[model samples]
Target: MNAPPLELLAARGTDLLVRVAAVACAARELPQLAEELAGLVVRCAEELTFCDVYVLDDDGRVLEASNRPPVPLGDADVGWVAAHGCARPHADGRGVAIPVRCDGATIAVVDVRSAGRCRDEDVALATALAGLFAPVLSSCRRLRAAKEREHAAERFAERAVEVQEAERSRLSREIHDGIAQRLAGLGFHLSAAERALPDDLPETAQQIALARRLCDLAAAETRAAIGGLRPPVLDDLGLSAALATLAREATAARLHVSVTVSGELEDALPDHVQTALYRIAQEAVGNCVRHASATCVDLLLEHDRDRVRLTVADDGVGFSIQDVFAPGRRPDSYGLRGMAERAELLGGRVSVTSRPGVGTTVEAVVPVPASRGRREAGGPG
Candidate 1:
């Protein structure tokens, strides 16, 4: 057969380069790129009878093939070209295999076959096309690696939150069942001893009374510890009731706290979501009383069809939110961080808005499960 003119060959090569560049630009992922490269090689090289594109992993294992009846990884030629990082022509003059390299390392292999002898120009063209694809493949590899790392970090954060919650629950149970029970028993024993005392022994009676008073104090302390670890109201009455109880307690502490429910929340939310919201509210209210020196705080719970929103606002001196959350500015903002982390685990967000001399508002919004129906709107209480 007569060889094509130099001009025709040059034009064909330019067209092939343009098509390959187009494929590279349009491909958003590795699989699509491999398929397009295979098709381009076959279409551009009219003399070739067969073409295949193979993507390889870092270990030279085949990850994907772009041809039907794909070439098997067990093929000796494929392995040889990949391992050696060089092109190889078949001894029978029927095909040529080329290794694609990126950053001085072999990343993939291309194999093309012809019915007759393969031309030198055809082999060169195949090698050049593979080179063009290297950078795209490299970029894809890095993107995949970054995504895997992000997923791993998310899993770690979730596990950390779960561990913290489990520990809190365990501590709460121990305090309620062990320490609280023992204190109650001691109080009863002291009462019985006081009753058993002789009428003439007035001093002994006073001593018994003092001992009973101490027991009462110890019991109260134990109850507080259990509540601090995990509020029983949250599990018993749900988020709104729990927040109302929190507000009452704050009020008792000389802070004017009010609870408002804006929508019907009769439907139960997921246990985790409720617990997270309650804890967030608890943290927000505690911050207002302790740090903000706020005299008045408002707790709001609003429910909609798809999400639930909780906001705690205080009218008191506020500080810079950015400075508090910035790195190394306030390491003691663990309470705020904990609140944010808890909300995040529930696929929710916690936002704090504040300015110096102005009041602060902490808000958390979390999605409701689809199975839970929306409640009717009602006047705030």
Candidate 2:
């Protein structure tokens, strides 16, 4: 057959491209975008004077067919094209499978079969269209993937919170019921030993004294673990009271801890914010004890007209915050990340400032919703 008019082919290809581009632009609003894209492919295939045209997924499954029977696009027909990895025509027939790549990964394929012997120009045109179509679809795919990942992460975090709560409950029960009772029993045993033993039984008295010391140590560990799980004071009192209690606990342990609060704080703050702030302070103080080894720690809370701020600072050894979250690092380093996550969930942000010699400070700022501010201003102090 005489060479097809190049200008006619070009014009036809451009018209089809314009239509497909319009469809792709509308894909975001289209409820059935895949079917719409498939329909566009079939329409373009028939209008372009080809024996047959088909669109395939990245896996080579036929997505849509034009001017050809609905035959499956299998590895047999398109695998060679993918392996050869170019927009070249098949040696045996007038067909080619052009790869459709978007964001540097193949997402689909465009296959053209022609009785007129497909030319390099035809292959080039098809390649261009495929490239355009790929990016549009790829963007959609990426958006969908991102939403899925976010939902999955949210579910995972919820599950994690549930597990953590369960663990805390179990620890609370064990300490309150088991360890505390054992310590009381041990103290009674020590008292009985002191009373029953005669003046000659000094060696037995020393053994009883040692047992009492061991019991005290175990009781301290149990309390520490239970406090780490869930601070009873935070539940019994409001945030200010809890902070005061924490400071006193640390001071009793020979760690100089001071807590300061400014502005009026009422009992109406949301539960999550209260919990997040409490947990943040808890984590920060724990880190100060474990990592800082500092003699002095400061906990500060400021609630005002617009926002609430909490700060935990320690004068001790600090670390490189950048390396703190690196993979394969110590699990204890997750303290900062966890604190940040909690603050973010409360629509707040957390910042960590540290230097090797100076010290470390963790601060969180959370905006109180307008209603809370209004209520706080009007309510009695």
Best-performing candidate as measured by lDDT: 1
Off by over 4 Å in 2: 1-170, 197-204, 264-267, 304-307, 367-381
Model 1 CA lDDT for position 346: 63
lDDT of each: 0.76, 0.67
lDDT of 1 by residue, 1-381 (tens): 123333334557576556766888887465667778777777777577777777775345554565444344546677677767888888898898888789887777888998899877677667667776778877866655564464455456556656777899899898888989998999999999998998999999998899999999999888877887888888788877888888888887789888988876445666767777888988899898789989999888998866899999999899898899889898758988988888787667999899999999999998764441221111111
Question: Alpha carbon lDDT of residue 320, candidate 2?
Answer: 81
Q: RMSD in Å for candidate 1, one decimal?
A: 8.6
lDDT of 2: 0.67
For every model shown, the clashing-pair count is 0, 0
Alpha carbon lDDT at 373, candidate 2: 49
Q: TM-score for each prediction?
A: 0.64, 0.50
